[model samples]
Target chain A: MDKILKSLFDFQRFAGESALQSIITSVEERFPANEEKSPRTALTAEEMDQISAAGNAYLQMEKDKWENLVNGGN
Target chain B: MAVIDGEEVYLLYRDKVRGYISQHVNQREEVEDLCADVFEKVVSSLDTYDSTKASVSTWIFTITRNRVIDFYRRNREHAELPEELASTEMLDAGLLREETLRELAEALMKLSEEKRTIIILRYYNGLSLKDISDKTGISYGMVKVKHQQALKELKKIMKI
Candidate 1:
């Protein structure tokens, strides 16, 4: 029973991965033709600053939450 | 760069989360958005994470599954699914790998939200029954039964 279940699961994993790759490939192929030549675009300075700020905020929030929980705020 | 195991979790589970969203969501753009949302939720909820109850991958899947359910609920109220999805072409199980996946996805889309979620968590995420139960707040016994039923239903839909 376990072996059968495992086999079925393995097949399902293969099927799911194949499906995801298909979706990603299809989406990649559908990118704007003009944009294809410059697939890699640089983040603007302001956009990079915003990303960095968001990352820092997220890290701080995680730290604060963990600290509170550990300190019996749960 | 290093902060109390954040990088390890990201490196370990990022692809798994993306794959989960891609397999379960309808649109490619939504998949990308939901993948980011899943990680954001994961980051925020990291304090509550209990490794003893479930692995990080299973935790991520739980978040993705809930988000997909919410998407369906919102969309079902506003739009009708494409009719092509209801046809036998979308049920084919032996098409090329890519096409078959699309068919499998279509089949999954036809299932109830609960059923689709259980199937994805159990099969696609490789989560154990107990882990699924812990993540979903369902019982272990219920997870086993639901998983069995979900697979049976999927197999029937795929005609496999």
Candidate 2:
């Protein structure tokens, strides 16, 4: 039973933004986002900074990886 | 196409990915960490992405979902993982395309209002039949019946 339900729910992951948006539209129609308390809270400034730093780090890592490959991994 | 510009992809998806992580993770620091981890993965695995199989947003969503699942598994050792978060085998790549999802959306729209509501509640919201019964004020038996009917209808419409 659980396995069946998992399979049913899993397919939605394949749904693109537009299709997922439609399902979300239906979900919100039945269950309004504001009517219920959401777990998400406004991100603090520090957290935002942290995320920015992480992005910069990843960008640098990706750049280095590409450079290494281009340089024949020297 | 391979992601030649990692920063571009990161900038585009960072907020959306952060929002999703914040929903599943309570700690502010952990949310930030997970968001970073997800983007790091996106950057590292850029070569593996096939745009034809799924859209960039869908790919990011899958990565985010998996990270949250891993977070929960690591943190909540004693508690049962929600059925919604439990990993399932990836379906065939052809079926994972946006076209299939569009077809599914069309089929879902064709369902009766009652059946559509039940299906969205069950699958989209990850609510169990009993939970749907309580929320909709329907009896458990009827919710189950309607859920089955909705699935049957979808199968017929989709020929799946």
Q: Specify the highest-DockQ model's number.
A: 2
Q: Could you tell me how far off, in angstroms, the CA of residue B62 lies in candidate 1 after the best superposition?
A: 1.0
What is the per-residue lDDT of model 2 for residues B1-160, given as tens digits with 9 covering 90 to 100?
7555689988888988887767557789999999999999999989999886677766777788788888888888654555555634343334444555677778878988777788777776677789788788889999999888888888888777
**Candidate 1 lDDT by residue in tens digits, B38-73:** 778877878787765554544555566566656655
Query: Of the candidates shown, which would achieve the greatest TM-score relative to the real structure?
Result: 2
Native contacts kept, each candidate: 0.08, 0.31
TM-score, A chain, model 1: 0.46
Give candidate 2 misplaced runs (Cα > 4 Å): A1-16, A23-27, A30-74, B1-3, B76-80, B87-94
DockQ of 2: 0.15
TM-score of chain B of 2: 0.79
Estimate, for each residue in A1-74, the C-alpha lDDT of model 2 and write its tens digit: 23433444454543324765676686677676446655899999999999999999999999999998999956
